[model samples]
Target: MKSFWCEQAWLPDGIASRVLVRADRGTITSVSTVDTIPLGCERLYGVVLPGFANAHSHAFHRALRGRTHSDGGTFWTWRDRMYAVAERLTPESYLHLARAVYAEMAIAGVTAVGEFHYLHNGGNEMGEALRQAAVDAGIRLTLLDACYLAGGIGQPVTGVQERFSDGTGERWAARVAELREDGNTRVGAAIHSVRAVPRETLSLVAGAFPDRPLHVHLSEQPAENEACLAAYGLTPTELLHEAGALTARTTAVHATHLSTKDIGLLGSAGTGACFCPTTEADLADGIGPARELRDAGSPLSLGSDQHAVIDPLLEARGLEHGERLRTGERGRFTPADLVAALTNHAAVGWPEAGRIEVGAPADLVAIGLDSVRTTGCAADQVVLAATASDVAVVVSGGKVVARNGVHETLGDVGKLLKAVV
Candidate 1:
């Protein structure tokens, strides 16, 4: 029995006004753009939009944002530094770190997150710690419990990365199932990449998790592509397709070095590409043909991978910005497209149905039209000009987790980060 009205709203098509939205049992019960605000309903005077869904995230990586940029190196060198951070995490430490990081996402107006987690072997306590962290942070997590058995296509984990492996594919599935949730979090599956997971292991993961979401890191590096081609005589995309992992529920993260045929396969299979713009740009992972993928009818989503950047507005802008840089064009997507990716398409990575329509979860954000980045801006300007700091209110599943520019879980984050990171 919760209801609210916004002065302006982002409907499926365009900027709308006088939107009367009702919620019951956390689902959006009704919506009307032409209706007047109810006399006693809670109302927010700003441009209200659907909450952003982060299709991919590594919560613990938020600790490594500034530390990884000093050396101009490939993803391998970055992995060394990343490994150092991953090695130091105990379950308690991870929970503490993740709680803070998820709060930051809430403030950024990201309601649900798909965490591609692989740091598994600190023991059973580590599993408990990750689960608690997701709950404390208020993000409905799809803990894509990853099967990372090898260092490359043919090599086993040799050093710090060994902890990410769960010994065998059977053990990996057991561990993934143990990281479950019935209420808040939805546990999902992940193959760290074709490099980290062998061909037999790929089929094992797919066979274990039938009719569920599967995510994998694909073609993010030239080395990975070269290694995959050398090992399998096929591109990473083809290897995956050959293993029968390409499906509508499958999500390919950082799909940068794909061929035209690979793109066509992904489009035809109805698989989604999750673009982690800032992380890809920071790592020099090459531009993903997002515009090409979109034109091919592949659904595109966004993620704040590696926590190099946490702003969905900035992520949306990065999508357009990358397009403009490639084509020398302005406004690659209308505001509606930007909003849809953040809201609807990104939701494909999660369990909940997204939209302001009936039976959809009440995950929404109310942007402050009067904020510094929003001054003299309409709903379109919010996407074009605003940052995460401009997000004023965040509501998820009929619960208010963030309000008035602050999240309920914001305190102690700076302190928790300083100790572990």
Candidate 2:
């Protein structure tokens, strides 16, 4: 059993003071809003918030950070370099890279992660090697094993993309079945995109994982939209709908170029939408319908996407930045909403996570209430002011991974990260 006594903690509804929280094994056992410190529990001061859930990520992409920025190109061109890096990763190298990257995320206060895993079929064991790497990294991974077939609408996977593709949806299913889930890792599916995947496989993938999380990249580029429209005679969202892919368990990533009906079907189908704001802006993917989707009551979450910037605090803030730019208003997104996106929206996208309420896993981040960022701020100010650097302590599953911004597993992540870049 472990207990945390804090001066302030962010409850689901709002911020409260003098909180004492207890955990047994991994789940929260007890929670109290009392000012008095407990007898034998560990005491930690400052502001405690729910551990941020990274809804989407590619762990290996952490290596390609600064290298991607120096080149000025579209997402397609950027992918070429990414593929070259992807080709060189062995299971051992991947584990080493992912361990260091997840440690970086822990330091930034991300308690759990949804790894959009696609690298598969190098060894005799296939992607089993890659899945094991995430388990060793100490972050809860949702392996979104992708069905990458075509290079584009008609082009076939040749060199590096061969690893991402199986013979067909049948082969993909056989491989997906090979993945065994553990407490820390859950296997999921991604349809890659209309460009890299066939439309027919959408049904095959989703139906196989009924009631499980299914994420797909939708209309991220104007070119992708035009191509899907030209080939399939519909936008990517409509094609998925026709193939019975969009459902309650599905999440449509970067629905940036959806039609009025596309957005309507998304909200009506109860599909979750994940907006990777930083990647969207960097790739010139254009402003997503953030306000529109929120108004339509679609569940919204955030993702680091390419690891261009791995900070969830900034990801939360970037969502607001996109909304503000579109609406010509500041404070467009409330602190409560952003916190939910960073925390509990993980629940909608990842049913296993999302909030800090009891019975939820004891994943949390503690920030200094008196830090320079929060010098004159209050509860809302905690989110408004704090950055990833201000995250002082990170606990995932009742185990302290980072304390005072120092990761216990990896020392000086920035210094190590530079080696790959």
Candidate 3:
């Protein structure tokens, strides 16, 4: 059993002072308000938030963070550089890189990550490496194994994309079926995109793991939508809807370029929209219709896709900032809304995580109210005002894994990342 006392904790109802949380075997057993600290409890100061869930990621892309922007280029040019990194990674090298990436996520207050992995290399070894890396770094992982079959809408696999395809959709399913879930890892499925997956195969990938979470990269770039429309005579969203892939369990990552009809299809189908605001901005992927998507019925979640920035706080701020810049109005999403998106563990298939309540995983993140970045901000407004540097303590699954941007057992995350990337 473990116990922790929070100065202020974000409860389901609202923020509560002097909150005492008790956990047993990684499950939160009880939460209550108390006036005095218990004798043996760990005390967490400042504002305590539920752990952030990075709902979309590609771990290997962390290597290309600062290396791809020397020359200004479109998303396609940036992807060419990304593919080069993917080609060089083996199972052993990827393990080290992902361990560092996950540790960096932990220190930034992210407890779980949904990796949209498409680097198959013709087997499950790469996926196995990612699973081991997550365990080593002390965070939960949803391996959203992506099915990438084509070079484009109708083109065959070419160049480095050969490593991403399993030859066919059936082969992809067989490879995925071999992946087993453990206490800290869940196996999910993803369609890389309408462009990468042919229409005939989209349904197979979506139905491969029906009981698990299904994610897809949806219209992140205008070129993709244009290509998809030119080939299929239907928008990407319409193609996905036609294939019956738009469901509550399905999440459309980067539903950025969408029409009125497309938004309705996603919203009415109850598909989640995961916005990687930092990466979208870094790649100049354009501002997505985040608020409009939510209003129409899609739930919103956040992620650090390319590792251009690994801060969930900054992603939250960027989400709202993008909305402000696009709409010329403030408060597009309230702080509570942002918090909900930040901790939506269900978006990554961890339905019982991301809450400071009984029966949930005992994941907690303590943000320093006294830090220079967050010094005078209101408790509710900290999401907008603070950065990852404000995170003082990160507890995952009832265990303290990181403190002040350093992993408890892995030592310095910066050193780990520096060695790998």
Candidate 4:
């Protein structure tokens, strides 16, 4: 059992002051207002929000962060460099790299991550490495095992792409079934893209895991849409709809190049859209219709895809900043909306998390109100003004995992990343 007295807390209804939160076995048991501080309860100052959820991630892509920018390449060219990194990773090396990368996420106030994993070296060795990495980093993991069968719409796997293929969709399912979930891990499914998974196998991958979260890389570049249309006469969103892939449990990553019809189809099905604003900008991918997708009935979430930047606060700020730049208007999304997207654990299959109320996971992030970036900001609007550096303390599963940019169990995250990267 553990207890914390918060100076300010983001409750479901609104922000509250002098709140007491109690937890037992990693779940919140009660929350109430208190006039006096209690003994033995940890003190958490400033505004404590629910821990952020990174909805879409490619953990191995962390290796390509600063190395890919010098050439000033396009997304296709970037893929060539990314492939170079993927080919060299063994399960042993991946565990070291992913452990360090997840530690970086932990200090950024990320309590849970949806790793869009596709780099399966012909078996579950890589997936098991990721599961253990998250455990060592003291965070929850949803290993979104991806099915990659084709190099393109009609192209066959070549080079390092061969490692991602499972020969058939049934074979992919059989291997994914071997992945077991424990207390810190959940197993989910991902369709690598409409380009990699063919028209016939889309439904097979979609229905393979009937009760888990499903994600897909949707229309990140114009060339993908062009190839998809030229081959099947349907946009990526339309193709997924045809295959019965869009649903309340589905999240379409990088919905940047969608048509109005594509947006409508995804919205009507209650499918979620996860925008990696920093990655989209880093890869020269245009700003997605985040406002349009939200208004169209699709829920919105955020990610650090590729880790050009790993700060969830920056990702949330970039989300609004991108909207303003797109429409020439400010305040496109409210601070509350950005916070909601930041803590959208449901997008990653943890429906009971991302809240501070009773029965939810006791994951909390304490942001210092007096930090250099957050001084003089309103309590409710700090999401707009703060960065990950303002994170004073991070609590996941009712345990303090990080403090002041330093991981609790792993020591210095920078040195860990320096050793691996």
Ranking of all predicted structures according to lDDT, beginning with the best and ending with the worst: 4, 3, 1, 2
* Cα RMSD (angstroms) for every candidate in the order listed: 2.1, 1.9, 0.7, 0.7
TM-score of 3: 0.99
Sliding window of 10 residues with minimal summed lDDT for model 1 = 344-353
| Residue-by-residue lDDT tens digits, candidate 3, 1-421 | 9999999999999999999999999999999999889999989999999999999999999999788878898898999999899999999999999999999999999999999999999899999999999999899999999999999877999999999999899999999999999999999999999988999998898898899999999999898988888888899999999999999999999999999999999999999999999999999999999998999999999999999999999999888999999999999999999999999999999999888999999999999999888889999888989899989999999999999888999999988999998
Candidate 4 structure quality by residue, lDDT tens digits, 1-421: 9999999999999999999999999999999999989999989999999999999888889988889878697999999989999999999999999999999999999999999999999999999999999998989999999999999999999999999999999999999999988899999999999999999999999999999999999999999999999999999999999999999999999999989999999999999999999999999999999999999999999999999999999999999999999899999999999999999999999999999999999999999999889889999999999989999999999999999999999999999998988
lDDT of prediction 2: 0.78
How far off is residue 125 in model 4, in Å? Answer: 0.8
Clash counts for all predictions: 0, 2, 0, 0
Q: Each prediction's TM-score against the native?
A: 0.94, 0.95, 0.99, 0.99
Tell me the tens digit of each residue's lDDT in model 2 across 57-137: 887887777776675878878889889988988776776677777777878988777767778753324345545654554
lDDT of 1 at 188: 72
CA lDDT of every candidate: 0.80, 0.78, 0.94, 0.95
Which number leads on lDDT? 4
